[model samples]
Target chain A: MFECLFEQASLLKKICEAIKELTDQACFEVSGTGISLQAMDSSHVSLVSFLLRNEHFSQFRCDRNLTLGLNLKMITKILKTAGNEDRVTLRAEDDGDHLVMVIESKTGNKISSYEVKMLDIDQQAFGVNETDYKASTKMSSEEFQRICHDLLVVGDTVSIEMTKDGITFSVSGTETSGCITCRQSGTVDDESVGTEITLQEPMNLSFALKFLNLFTKATPLSNSVSIEMSADQPLCIHYDIGDMGNIRYFLAPKIDDEEGAGAAGAPAAAPTEAAGGDDE
Target chain B: MGIKHLMQVILENAPDAVVENPVPSYFGRVIGIDASMALYQFLIAVRVEGQQLTNDKGEVTSHLMGMFTRTTKMMAAGLRPVYVFDGRPPEAKQNELARRHEVREDAKEKEAEAKEAGDQAEMERFSRRQVRVNQQHCDEAKRLLTLMGIPYIEAPGEAEAQCAALCRAGKIWATGSEDMDSLCFGSPILLRNLTFSEARKLPIREVHLDQVIAGLGLTMPQFVDFCILCGCDYCGTIKGIGEKNALKLIKRWGTIEQALEHLDKTKFPLPESFNYQQARALFQQPEVLDPARVDLRWGQPDEEGLVQFLVGEKQFAEDRVRATTARLRASKQTATQSRLEQFMGPPAIMTSCSAPPGPWPMVQGPIVLTPSPFPPLRQQAGAAAAEKGNKKARTSAKGAKGAAKATATKPAAKKR
Candidate 1:
């Protein structure tokens, strides 16, 4: 049996919104520590790993580690019906075919109970081993999202070059060419629109703008994002989803595309110590 | 490339989404209608021989006539319809619009050839294909709808998108359109063949968007991608990617990009510079007016204006207009009465049998009931009507006595 309560439905709603885009159905592993979901998109081009600490819940319990498979879209739809302030509680039994959920008003007067059928998803425990990246950047998610949105019109691929000068995102298409540069800032400021970058070595990588846009779907989960990249590995975009845990997205870079070469000059890479904002 | 047979694919794959519901079951429900689609359907269906319906002045009257009968029938059936008209179309629709234009132009040339050859069948078919809805047609349609007290709104973009937005905002119950793209637009419910004749063997169908999402087991974004793959008005489809392939690929790979990668490029080459993402964005968030600003009201029809437009200007049979208007008025009354009964429990009826002697003095013999205030007007002039009325009167008189006895015996029985 497993049960958890969220004081605010918006948190759960944000989590579901971030994952539903990547997968229709996901297996959620419920353990004593918390509930965590790890699934790769159908294409296997990207993987989304989400963790929600058990202590973050007002009430959390688990008799055994049970894997509850749920249709993320269904959860998103049900969550759409919940008011942002409604208290949400989820309960399920070991090997149960259904997951029961209750949403209540803050005052506990209005209550709605929903029972969503659970799927028989095989237990699959997987994790991405920690990687020491050649270069990483800590920047405002809003700025990153804006960069992706604006460059989307110019081309389909975005090239990121990290160096001592700062990280630069540039795109070039048949008719339009544009570049946005974010110089590393030395101080922490506003939560949104703040730019900070940490670069250990000069690294240049390219990724599909569409996938980058999809990653920004997690923008609502965090105000800041940390981008870690290695030579030819998939870029890891991490968002700290409040006190609960973090949601990380690993997106494969576009290996070879004409847009990469045609884009404005690929800035020379610069090497420097990793920014202090990176993970300890 | 509006995914050829995308609707058929949805119908086949998500059978549970489509439901055959009775027309009357939708009574009291507000339906958002695509006015342009309805007009186009009318132009195609309501033709006599190879020619279109026109007024004495040679102006097309098919739309006016079609909407008149359809709105009247819907009103009589207690279904409130609010028509939505398409405004300036998006630039992306230019290709589709041009394609349609070419089709009509080709049909026009064929129609002339058929006419010269005296091939009646070919001429009829090509002539039907050449039918088009223009500005004057739209103006007359709006004018007629206005005179009939029906509510209509001109959407800033696609009418179906506006209808879907209204459904999303809870401004309307469902959208009525022949195309299933309304599903892609995220309409909560889409009623198909709402304008088709009931005499046909096929039944009217409705698809719930929620069930569609559940049945497809795809997230809304994936569903939109699926639609784009099959084809959409906004963009071209990847060659050789039909409905079945698109569904299989989307369901298997989750997105077009992955599906494209998995597919053999030699068999299905991706279009050059295919803007599937842009098309996806268009479906994900269509431009529509704020729902709160929309005001939908059903007011009294302008009888004088209707007659002036339909009979005086459009040369409709005056008697036909009068008869339809009368029917509309009567149905409106009945609908109101039914609505009242539905809300406030059934109206209190006087039990004529009770003999408490509070309101009226006791009558020694059979008490005659005054003739009913409301009677079938035509029936009242016939002998059968009198006989029926007399029988009803006698039954009520006897009913009064019987009721009194039952009431009187209840207390005695209790005492015993």
Candidate 2:
């Protein structure tokens, strides 16, 4: 009645690390097909959308489809206490309200279990439309995470400009502005340029670096992650969830001072000109 | 008797009545004292203790000691103390913070000037008599409040005003303050003499909004007039007129305009334009103190964990902490037990058996999660095929080539 197994515990730990940045609490909606979680941080700057399909788990069993709202910090604590070689097993006892997470080490050591409360969260479905993004590119998760971390030192906000050639991550402060661009000419060794879609419309969106860093922490789960951006719209980052499913994050762009004041004096910088330029 | 002796005689005779006479039940419960201000008073009291108040190290130590004592006493009282810390003040209060800052700066300058002038006595006096509250101390107070399990609200502006709002709204029974402005701000109950004695012994003066207006011999509008004439927050008042004169003027005239008409324009002058209406609105408009809706659940206390954190980590005195914790534990047993019971319930059964172990582990089996399962992409593709039926046929040929690459890479990528 209380035994379930997973090949690796590290994957869950990585996932927890990713979402822990966005929000302190999230509801994991598990159904017959897969598990999905959609939650926005308190600031509404970022949202963590995670999906793990049924095929990912080696032996998944359930009496019914259930939703467990978990505290991110508690889950991260349990995961941190676990060894990497340990096989993850989660079990339910005492009427599905409590969770026991066990990690069995390779040396035949007794599995250590941590009992956590499954809180009843007020789940409200947010109506978010799936928009057709202007451009999409895949880059290494490590690179993305590193870029976000470095950019945070400069400022709290980052402006992401994507075009036909590649992606440009820019941050501007009162004194200085920094930009990192990956174009067709200067392609990194491990990175892949799938397809270049021309920017019929150039969009410059600002987002909080804190949320970006948190959501990108899921990068270790996949070698490469895909990013899709549309001007004046939410940026969607897709993480390939091995054979299980995919985790897609939709982040609402911050309203910068220029764009918010009715676009009157804001420069219409040709997104094509800055598409692959190193100049900030 | 001499003035000091007469003051002592009066203090002995009165001894400050601890509990005021009980009034109507409409007055709210559990008054909130501005903890930061209370801490300031406690620190001053400590400085006054044992005739030794001149040392900087002594001042800091005394403040810290007072903090612990106040925390312990508040915990033993059984009153849910909601301490409110001031955040960024509103633009209106910028002047106040700046004014205080300027005064502190001037005091520092004066101390320096006195030192340079070889006025050692004045310099020592100024150093010892410094009354400025430090941000570090305020932060420490907040840390202490958190440890003590006293719920605190970070006020966007003035702590006293927020406390007053809380009182008027019936969120709290009264505001524990020496400042009479709370009454002007329409706080239903204002408890004085809290510092002088224990809460049980202290008299809480429950001042009703209607009674205040009636007792002051003015309508709600004219009562605000009396306060403004007696010096409201927004601006300075007439120099000569005291509270008694302002009250008499307001009662006779029935309005500030009427009072102004009777005043000597040259000596008892008024500002160019008085915003008495806004002031009236602030003081007269009763705050919605929705008591029933406040989430009072303090959650389960990890007593052992708290003990380990405070005593072991922070190096707080064990016996003193143990005593305070014992009292808190006794009072909080029911809530804590219920929370613990809830947390110890049944576990979660993983739904997807065949799902790969990843971030979003899916449930095994051929299950279509979405109700309309042409799949969103398939539906869009079908619609695109229908719309660009002819032109996309050639594009589809190129798409097939891309699809071939995707198919080839999918399996190998999954292996890693």
Per-residue lDDT of candidate 2, residues A1-280 (tens digit) = 2334677778888888888777787777543334567676543445566666443466655433345667889988988877776788876642456677988886756778788886645332332346677767777777788889998877766878777676788987545779888673434344542323345566566676766787777877887777787765567788887755667776666552222133223221111121232112
Interface RMSD of each candidate, angstroms, one decimal: 35.2, 23.5
Locate the minimum summed-lDDT window of 10 residues in model 2 chain B: B407-416
lDDT of 1 by residue, B1-416 (tens): 23468667667767878878677656667899988888988888776664778888898887888888878888777677888877788877787799899999999999999989999999899988887878677777777776776778777788889899999998898999987778888999999888875556455688888778777778888888998888889888788888788888999999988887899989888787578877787777888877777766665566777898899988989899887887665444431211222211222211111112122112222221322211111112122323333232212222222222221111110000
Residue A92, candidate 2: Cα error in Å is: 1.9
Tell me how many clashing residue pairs each candidate has.
3, 39
Which regions of candidate 1 are displaced past 4 Å?
A1-280, B1-3, B198-202, B336-416
Instruction: Report model 2's TM-score to 2 decimal places.
Output: 0.42
lDDT (Cα, tens digit) per residue for candidate 1, span A1-280: 6788999999999889888887787777554445666666543456677777554566776654455678889999998889999999999875566889999998999999999997644322222435678898888888888899999999876889998778899887756888999887754654445556666679987776867788889999888899898875678898988866788887766554232233213211110121111110
How does residue A229 of candidate 1 score in lDDT? 89
- Candidate 2, residues B1-416, lDDT tens digits: the string is 00112112213332332235422111212556666676666555655433323333333544445655554454444344565555444443344456667776777888898989988777766654465557666665555554544455555455667677777566776777665666666666666555443434644444455555654445656656677677655544576777667767878888877887889989876665456565555556533233344432222234564466456645557786677666654433211101101211211213221222222222223222323321322233333334433231322222322222221111110110
Q: TM-score (0 to 1) of chain B, per candidate?
A: 0.79, 0.59
